[model samples]
Target: MPELPEAETMARDLNQRVAGFTISQVLLAFEKIVASDLKNFEKTLVGHQITKVARLGKWIKFELDSGGALLAHLKMTGQFIMGDWPGHLSGQWPAHTRAAFLLTDGNSQQTLFYRDIRKFGRLRAFPQDELLSFLSQLGLGPDPLELKPEEFHQLVSIKKARLKQVLLDQSLVAGLGNIYVDESLFAAGLSPYRLATTLTADEASLLLSHIKRVLNESIAHRGSTVENYRGLEGPGSFQDQHLVYGKHGQNCPKCGQALAKARVGGRGTTYCPICQK
Candidate 1:
């Protein structure tokens, strides 16, 4: 699962590698992958020069010179990689590539492929006005990296759900998934089961600090690649730095007690019961 760090990595890599490239052709191996109208999807993308690439919460945004954009969400197992154009036959596509964009930088050309093993991802094309409208309607909370301490504390003070569940709510605070939430809570010495409304202002600030730290560190390492997550460059190495995520029943790094495993908001969570308590 590619969260903020992974999305950040992809956006950064794309800005560096593919920015300014013009979309010359659009090919769709699986039309359902597009969440927008089929009539305008390819027509709006092709012939547009990519002005920039960015991430809004967990989604990737591809900005064009014409003020239009292509937005992609790599839902579960989706990712982007460089590839060659496939043959006319559908079977000739590279493994898991549902869509491809042939790009040209005047002198050179390349192919950008969207791959998803589970086919759960979605892509959409929008004009300038429509893109702004869509983003406004998405209703995501502040990006954790840009969130102020007071803002985090205030948000936590209003929420009534468990700490982990509130953190997982994109509407409350965007970009936190199971891995970073557990890691942040453990690092802050807070239990995932703790109610968000019960946290003191100082504790909420402390948790915010830990959340930013974990996310920044993961972004630096290019995000965790515990599963199928891969940036434009390659798989991330941050999984090597994980403390509690996916490490159930293992010895806690902070305490000798065995790490406990449970479900918070139906997401598999891992933490040190002794330390977190």
Candidate 2:
């Protein structure tokens, strides 16, 4: 799954390329990807100019001048590819390509392709009030990259679940995934199995600082490309330096101990026994 940083990067990129362009065509190859009836969805978007592009959690919001937003959630294998006009690429869906948005500048057209192999990506047209109601359920704690150390400390000190699970929960801290959870724990010398509420206040403070450090570092490197998590334009190279997330049975970077792997919350977790408690 693309975490916060990746989604934020994609939103920023699309904001630059697609905002201010009018939707000349809204094509849906997979019906459920859109919110309303197919005809209604098309009717709502086809003539509206994109006023802005923003992100809420992992969802992409394309605010239109015509009074509704086109929101998309690129679940697991989804991608948004920008196709240049006059040389528009031709290819079949290939068990992917949930939807496509073609925008025009009256002189040129740009095709924003949304491809999701898992078929879980979603596109919705929502009124502002309805959208706000939907967002309210997410309990978005805060952007890890933007949280102050003191605020992060206060939030984590109150949780009682395992440290790893607490970090992964979107309600507690909005953008972290399995990869960053492991990396952050390893950085802070806390075991993935450490009980969240069992930590001392000092430990909690350290954990908070370490979480931001790890996440900000990951974003600076364009996030880890563990699976197919590519940057907006293409795949990134950050996977090359991951300290523990995917380095099972390999030597830990800091202490040279073997990195271990196990199942936590049903996801693969990797860490260093000596370095991470």
Candidate 3:
């Protein structure tokens, strides 16, 4: 699943590539991808020009000139690709693409494509106020990269859940997934199963700083490509730099002890048992 950094990167890329461009046509292969009735969805976007693209948590917001927004949640296996020609990249879809947006110049007919696979992704229309309302309802905590120590301490102190669960909870802190959660925990020398509320102010502060450091460093490497994640091509290079994630039974980068894997919140979690304790 695409987290904050991935979504934010996509938004920044889309903002640069799609903003100020008008929609010439939207081709919907799946209906649920659009929130409104299909007809209304098509009508609402047909003539609208993209004003900006921004990300809130894992969701991508495409602000239109009319003050409405197009929201997309790229759950998994979703790729939004822009090209100088329509359907320029075809083979990536077949079984994966749920929808396509052929963004055009609205004058010369040049087009770009937004494609998604697995049908898990979606594109929806939301008025500005409605978008805000939806975001508020999501209980999404602040972006991990932007979280301050005070805010991080306060959130952690209130939770009695396991540290891993608390970190994975979107409502507590947005953007962290299984990969970064393990990475952050390892970086902070904290065990995944430790009680969240047991963390002291100093420990929480360290965790907070490490989370930002890990995320920023990962983003600098264009995010980890554990699987199908890609900036534009195949897997990213950051996965090579992972300290413990997916390294179960491998040597810990810090302590040389065998890394361990345990199920946390039903997700396979990797950590340096020696260092993270």
Q: Write the per-residue lDDT of candidate 3 for residues 1-277, one digit (tens) a residue.
A: 8776677677777788888888877766667777645666777677888999888878888888877778888787776775554343552444445666667665655454445656677677766666678667777888877878888989987998899999999888887888888888999999999999889888999999988887778767766776676654334566887888898999888888899889988889998767886
TM-score, predicted candidate 3 vs. hidden true structure = 0.90
Ranking by TM-score: 1, 3, 2
**Candidate 2: TM-score?**
0.89
Best by TM-score: 1
Q: Look at candidate 1 and tell me the lDDT of residue 127.
A: 84
Q: Model 1 — which ten-residue stretch has the worst lDDT?
A: 82-91
| Candidate 2: clashing pairs of residues | none
Q: What lDDT tens digits, residue by residue, belong to model 1 across residues 22-60?
A: 999888999999998888999889999999999888989
Better of 2 and 3 by TM-score: 3
Model 1 clash pairs are none
Report the number of the highest-lDDT candidate. Answer: 1
The residue-by-residue lDDT of candidate 2 on 47-161, one tens digit each, is 8999999876667889989768888877787788887534234535434677778889888777888888787777877666665776786567777777776677677768877
TM-score of each model, in listed order? 0.96, 0.89, 0.90
Q: How many residue pairs clash in all the candidates, one count each?
A: 0, 0, 2
